[model samples]
Target: MTGRQVIVRRARAEDIPGLVASSAGLFAEDGGTRDSSVNVDWPREHGARSFAAALDDPARLVLAVEHDGQVVGHLMGSLTGPTAKRPVTSATLVSIHVRPGHRRARAGDRLVEEFLDWARRQGAEHAEVTAYSANTDAVRFYERSGFAAMTVTLRQPL
Candidate 1:
């Protein structure tokens, strides 16, 4: 789709539903699965409430990209603690997702651009984001947006 247009802007409480749906898509695409119906209902309610709260947080940034009047993507970035060990003001990209049909339209780039601008204005000196080690698409997106491999994390089922 050439010559397509997308708008990226601050998310409002009304966008919470779409935001949660996009988040579910991100989780699923990242290899997450639902074990029961409660899984969906729980996150749907909890995620919506969280996103709605973040929308009002001055220290956080939540932005959405819309196409043809429908929200197609969302990005959430947050300011992290600056302790002596990590003294610099850091902004961690909590999550970002673009609907399947919305990929390649630069919506993700626009979201990152807006988030970075906000993070900088809020005194963040460093930015970080984590991706599933095997989800190269997300890793590539972050790399293209100027992120480099900074740390390695390992996990195991307990």
Candidate 2:
């Protein structure tokens, strides 16, 4: 697993399928308690079309981690607003997914690195990502990549 073997690059529309597939299993494992089939349809169900639209937007950044000519991981983020008091620009990391086989091999790190680089290039003063509270591994991954726990989002279904 030499770092040189893996390449990180901006994602194209063609890469969406792979990114969606990579996330399906993780998404199911993390949530989707009511119906198992809900997990498999997450890509399209969660607005893949809108995601494609955003990916093509200049205001957004999407990157993929490729190994041996296959996209094994991907990360996406977008600029928000000067929502904070410090004249900050908010960037939300919409997604980060690595193929199961590529976990723990720095693929995730590379994706996050590219994401942060894109955010900084866009003049973002603050970056934020939401992770499932039950997903400890994801929390650790973000923390290891220099992210901190800012606030908790409590939800209640009506």
Q: Best-fitting candidate, measured by lDDT?
A: 1
Native RMSD of candidate 2 (Å): 3.0
Q: Rate the local accuracy (lDDT) of all candidates.
A: 0.82, 0.77
Summed backbone clashes in each candidate are 0, 0
lDDT of 1 by residue, 44-96 (tens): 65888889889888878989888888778899999986788988889989989
Winning candidate number (TM-score): 1
Candidate 2 residue 41 Cα shift, in angstroms, is 1.8
Off by over 4 Å in 2: 33-40, 83-87, 156-158
